[model samples]
Target: MTKKSETGSTKSETKSKSEIRNWAPINEIANDVRAGKITALSNVEKSIGLIEKHSEFDAIISVLDEPAKKRAKQIDARVNNGEKAGRLAGVPFIAKDNFLVFGGETTAASNILKGFEAPYQATVINKLEAEGAICIAKANLDAFAHGSSTENSDFFVTKNPIDKTRVPGGSSGGSAAATALSLAPFSLGTDTGGSIRQPASFCNVVGFKPTYGLVSRSGVVAMASSLDVIGPITKSTEDAALIMDVIAGKDKLDMTMIDRDILAYTKFNNNLTGVKIGVEKEYMDEKVDKEVKQIISVAIEKLKNAGALVAEVSLPSSKLGLPAYYIISLAELSSNLSRYDGQRFGYSYPDAKNLDESYMLSRDIGFGDEAKRRIMIGTYVLSSGYYDAYYKKAQIVRTKIINESREAFSKFDFLIGPTTPTAAFKIGEKSQDPLQMYLSDLLTVSANLDGGPAISIPAGFAGSLPVGLHIMAPQGEDRKLLGIANGFEELSK
Candidate 1:
């Protein structure tokens, strides 16, 4: 059994442990808190200690020290009063900096928005708080969610927790690293184009990107309006499902949100007797790492052994998904990022001659190189002469990808592949070459392009580095996707 110190004081007062390997799951922590085996304050202190010890990863951009402690005390009081706490009560979790939480700045890991405090809580934050989950800190990400790697973050690049020299994928890099290192039980991350799933794959954790419009994006910093979805990265699929239950619902604030019956995603814990799993031949080709492909092959065999029919399915349009996604995402980003023009909020450059100069100087200094590249690409694509050739053509291609995915799903319940072409690469491995970095997301971007639900679960390791099995289902099939992942998790275990 896991043990805790008895002194019941701040993290500074406790004796430190060196292993850095002992930590309990969220459900186990909650059970201990409720049964008085440990106090919530002690748990929060330990989490704070872990964060401080692993500061090199730069996973936490800001820690809500006082507010988190106060919230933990309130939860303990409620338990003492004999009140029923919600499912995730007294659990500690982190929210990516893109989320607007009350106690800390939602910088989105950009200098342009540094120290900008939110007046209102994000809907997902509010929902988790209602369930007694404490928002301990804000995790780092690619600034404005613009890049495939967290190197685009203005503050710092998040290192992969498994191997300190490698990167944890992004824009959800910090969230995945935090959970991987057990800094928090789970963390909320936003996925636009393979952000959540890819990072989770690198960190060997469970990352769930729900169906588009299933989770409210009311207060999330918008990257690509059509592709952004808030999801959870956790140690286990069941925990991911638990976090989803709290945050999934219709919100009047986000008009794109739909009112659908939210099912208990945990109920997906069953054998995969009748499930049909499809392996995309395009994703299994020679372009992917041999070991990563082997891991996925093993997962497919496990599913087949569990009585699920497995077959290779063709998604010819998937090859065009990355280019199409970049075009669409940049077009949307170009428009969304226009709001940061020094007037209303965010940072403004000094010594500007006029409005135009201020806008130009501020943005030039504020955005990183990769961000500027995308902005320029977006401007060029949306420009009058090239609009039809680039932007419009990408949209037409996107439509084709979506239609092809729908058709494939009509025959197979879920599509499976390697979540990423390889495991976590070195931190500076592909930073200088933007196109090489973009190709890192080749296998994971199709689901985002099609606006479907997808997940990445740890399948096995390629040597010491972990690989993830990618599973995707049609839009509005969040429950089914989780169920299928749960089935795979059980079989793999």
Candidate 2:
């Protein structure tokens, strides 16, 4: 069934949302479409052509060709009839594989869910559609979103858009690559730990993780209930802000969602004058690559010259964030993955004669190696006797990190660091070393632990690979974080 468009606005009915034409990517296409300068069908056609053109990148899993074309036609009809369209009218975007979106299977890149079609749409997807954004494709991700690289995807690893030899950062790797490849103006991604920001860093795009509970999580697959944040992978900060303005409001479907700020996120203050930024000293330690360090330092120096007060600050508990995140997220992952037994909507083992055998066989045959690894680890930590030793201790570490983050924010408006310790590594380089792979998120997981907002903007490259300048702000300060990020776009890149 075709998903319905939520609005039929005329030219005069369209609100003066923002002067989106000034933004080069997402809104430019939307403005032109509403003004009748270009048909929605024409943009959809171009986007389809690009998807086919870059099929080898493995960035996208399923293309919603028929439904997207149908929706585009509908938008063009409304525009032709002089009816108003929404803010993102006629714009196309991609969603990460795990989101429960219509038009294709919501597989999460794992065989266990290979044939799962969404019975309902994710809140973010619905919100975007209501604003007239069309989802043209589903992007690949680590199966069950269990790894730091798309290599964990049961089907195939997504290649970095800029350099096919390297891996796009996971588990939002495919979404990041799709945006960078220009398959769409923006794409949706989930950040638990650093899935969204790490990939965006590697692919030279912008990734924004809202303060926890700022965006509703309804209909999106849960990796870790407390940690998951739905966000956009976009070409620019302004475009991200525009998308957030539509999707950031509270939803009764998600009890955790908070009320969005009344001030429009689109009206961001990009002026950096007098902004106090804390450079994360821990992030610039010996383990960080010299070249990557240089890139981050250059960005800090640039900000300092722009009248921003910058100083080195420490969040030492952040050093333990990675280990804490793994224990917490995996425990939640194991619990969440429990519902995917053979009796449900996805793949089920046909040969099993007994109920217990069916459950054992289905999961054994269905989950990928990384998925199984996480499941075992998650279960191990949450087991009878080990719960206090592992899970409880991790939560203690998480709390310490949160307190440190709060203290850091009391003195500084935002924290700056390298999104990743290094630029994108070769596709197979860290695959065998789970420890190394887990380390990719060392710098980003702190924000999630703190339950605050964070973003990754393209910084200079480390050789051929693109790196991002990671920034963070305290809880409930998402709007200010977004504004500060918008200010550094030109200087960082």
Candidate 3:
């Protein structure tokens, strides 16, 4: 039940089950909080209450009950005092566990750092919190964001909110699942090689991966540093855009941050006149499931009906993206993971006799199977004899992919494709075959390799599950891409 003040006036009425289930978008809640129609405290209580109700999904790693309540009360006091509570005032959200957040551990779903507390907060988190958005919990992810299926998480597999038996799309699976189940209006996830968009597709929510360097990565856990970009998974493309305004910009800590004039993305233009969209030729291949293909085809037709000029385009280098992405990503991952040697950071082995043995035993006991496999593959590729053959070759291939993507963007305003080849698969379905699991990201990784912006929106459903329509735009065209995605998202409805 919603609470009232001692003055005998109701603070706010409780939201209906349908409204809560559908999740009132960010703007709606923020407006209510600002207008005093709803107290920030009430919003926090409701969010925490709903998360408890849906606890069976195992989507969250830890809850920030005390801090969230304290923040909400602070926001409520500001509102009562006739002060602005910031743009996102009183909107409760979730951060992927990989982000360094205070008041809780930043485990990244790995046992090696299970008890490690973050000394500070991620830039994105501080930005969101500054705008009065409350982070009530941390969502789970693959250990070190290494695997595509969240099953590699050292803690526990995050269940897809749609189908408990099916796997949520990973490395950002928990964030996507939390958004899908309406645990929050929006959630943060890091996209490196389709981590955000894939899970967004599986969960039938909107997931956006901005152009690399658009969002600052300061204070976030390193995972393939060059490939990692932070983005949002929200109930609507508009919500994602609203969040972009707060978090997207140059940061002093991350030298790679870009300075560009970004438009107000929430104000979408429905007119698609003169807009040319390319349908990636390879995305229509028979490898995609029949139902997923049909759904994507229908979504493309919606854009066409809205006066978008749709045509087929070929990017021959697209097929090489997945393998090249894995090589480059694993290589970077090996270097990033090398810091956890049990000398002064992460989990330490108590029974080791010597320093070398300590390094060996600590990593073996701390990292999960998927993480170990990637490390081994990475170490081998970057080895002295093989470095020139594999690591250097992968970089050359990456440049080719980026150049091809840029050339395509010269002719087309955006590229259209299916986010995933299929819907959420049953848990343990592809766990034994790592290769099969890797194929799940085949359609969504190119954007990451090319450092472009991409978004996944609910298109249509196959059977009881939903499919996503993936859209891509050239690097630094994030605002334009979000506008196109929002327009297409509206067309689907």
- Highest lDDT model number: 3
Residue ranges of candidate 3 with Cα displaced over 4 Å: 1-22
Worst 10 residues of 2 by lDDT: 12-21
TM accuracy, model 2: 0.94
lDDT of 2 by residue, 1-493 (tens): 0011123322311211111121247677889989998877877887888889878889999999999999999999999898988899999899999999888889999898998989999999999998888999999999988888899999999998767788989999999988887787789999999999999998878899998998989999899998999999988888889998999989999998778899999887878999999999899999788988988888898899988999999877778898999999999999999998989677799999999999999999998888788899999999999999999999999888888888888999999989999988998999998888998888999888888999999876666566799999988887788888888885543
The collision pairs in model 1 are none
Point out where model 2 deviates above 4 Å.
1-24
Which candidate, 1 or 2, would have the higher lDDT against the true structure?
A: 2
Query: TM-scores of the models, in the given order?
Result: 0.94, 0.94, 0.95
Candidate 3: residue 93 Cα off by (Å): 0.5
Q: Tens-digit lDDT track for model 1 on 252-324?
A: 8899986655557666645688888889999999889998898888888889989999999999989999999
Structure candidate 3, residue pairs in collision: none
**Which regions of candidate 1 deviate over 4 angstroms?**
1-23
Q: Which candidate comes out best when scored by TM-score?
A: 3
Give one clash count per candidate, in the order shown: 0, 4, 0
Which structure is stronger by TM-score: 1 or 3?
A: 3
